[model samples]
Target: MGVMYRPPNSGQDQGHKMHHKIESACQKGKVTVIMGDFNMQVDWVNNAASGPKEREFIECLQEGVLEQLVMEPTREQAILDLVLCNEPDLIKDLKVREHFGGSDHNVVEFNLQFERKKVESDVKVLQLNKGNYRGMREELMKIDWEQSLVGKTVEQQWQEFLGVIEDTVQRFIPKKRKVIRGEIRQPWLTKEVGECIKAKEKAYNVAKSSGKSEDWEGYKNKPRITKREIRKERINYEGRLASNIRNDSKSFFKYIKNKREAKVDIGPLQNDAGNLVMGDQEIAEELNKYFASVFTVENMSNMPTIQESQGAESNMVAITKEKVLEKLRGLKIGKSLL
Candidate 1:
């Protein structure tokens, strides 16, 4: 269960999806040994930022009871290559070898002696297509909310609302649950990079057969330069995305927001009585109680009131169709409706 060369700038959504896929696979495998080029430069020793994808990968390993074996830098200057195992003690002689086989990724060597356990896992994932939000809205509009909620208690009303929304989601969006198998693909591994890698491989084979030092050196240097080119292309691709901030502002902002979405998984929390509360119901109740106490008013007295100063001119202007149209025109185009 090794991942090689993750998409660098595919954004956080893909990274999270990839992490979950890997985690699910690890869970099902009896003796999991996940390795390969994660492309995340993590300084686990120094408590440094390892980017969102790397952080998620680390969290996945933690939750799955997996331990990373490779501790040294495997790439040029970064520990991009990783080797993880469920039984850290079982994984012995874990080290990064020199670049081999015409590849830029350094080889990770490890030994493990454990019986493969047969584990069954079922993962039900709800995937959403937010792009079809217009269709979702149309479905919602077709439902008579007032009629559905009529003659019901507050709790019943809430239940009805949830039921309708869940049903709508099932209808409008597609969902599937199945046995988890790790099958992650790198979309950013473009054809050009593929050709460059192939060329390096051909160079390596030729050097090996001819026993030429220059050819071997070329094999080594070619892959490095190719990797650099691939990296440059990826960076340039992100630069194009940055340029979209003006022309395609909605997508630009959405990308930024998704990239920064919280990956932290908050587990069970303790209540005031020091009892650990789990599940949605207990968590919501605890949160509501805490907020209610914080916002509770003691005595309602001497409240401040607003009074207009004498001779102060009112800034309110009369609404006009032309003024409204002008304002609308002034607003930036391609902005999200909501």
Candidate 2:
């Protein structure tokens, strides 16, 4: 989504430059939507543009395979606001009826045509936090591993142990159900704002068909009041979020996280197979393979110019459990923290 605002009467050069930038942007993105106040006085009925710059703008947009969706006048007699997309079917139900609070420009409401699959996790898991640890420990202690594993192979014994532990967990531990987190709601959206938006929509609908100047005047004044209310509500919302952040830090950080674009820590890397490795693990593996290829085995036969230490010529001994216990016994741990 590219947001743009070109000031009115800003020269033709600036318009050309902006169009060039938009063209460049369209070329890079798979699906692009450039929106906002372009301030172009276009004669959509006759398929004509007023100035040379507007004509060039339309030509440049077409060269880039872009489509301007807005046909109605967003501000008074000229269509200042515009919504453009590279793909023809990328934008759907493009409506220019409603006005946003505080702006003279009519709001362009539309939905991007796509399907986003919700990535749900597995259904059930152990809630260890609420588990009966004492009961589980007692149940485990009752199992005699020596006799249990006497006639079983290593793999069989492992399986048997796992089965017993699973049974114990089911008996003692509670289950947790994983669900998707709540969606990020707009911070500025309030009950008052919602009512105002509905009113603007209703007013716009009436003004479109009705010839009454009173109806047009009524619709025009709604936005100014709505904008003021929006500002107040937005400030209050932000203030509450700031003040209660310490108590509800998850929501605050989640909002922050949602605002920022997802970071690509590891970029696509080409592996030995000439295929792009996109995942973090795959990229790590590719890097590891590259690093492993550069490593050379050192020749032990030809040692470096250094003498071996001969100060302590004692032979090392094998470590036994008995020796470890004896060492522990010898320690003066009377005042040890542990």
Among residues 3 or more apart in sequence or in different chains, the pairs in candidate 1 whose N, CA or C atoms overlap within 3 Å are: none
In model 1, the Cα lDDT at residue 108 comes to: 75
Q: Give per-residue CA lDDT, model 2, range 202-316, as digits (tens).
A: 8878987895889988888877777778888988977887788756766777777877887547669997778988997688778988898899979999988978986978788
Per-candidate TM-scores read 0.48, 0.53
lDDT of 1: 0.73
Against the true structure, whose TM-score is highest? 2
lDDT of 1 by residue, 139-163 (tens): 8999888988999998799999999
Candidate 2 lDDT for residue 116: 85
Candidate topping lDDT: 2
What RMSD does each model have against the real structure? 14.2, 12.1
Residue 19 displacement in candidate 1 (angstroms):
30
- Ten-residue segment with the worst summed lDDT in candidate 1? 179-188
Candidate 1 structure, TM-score to reference: 0.48
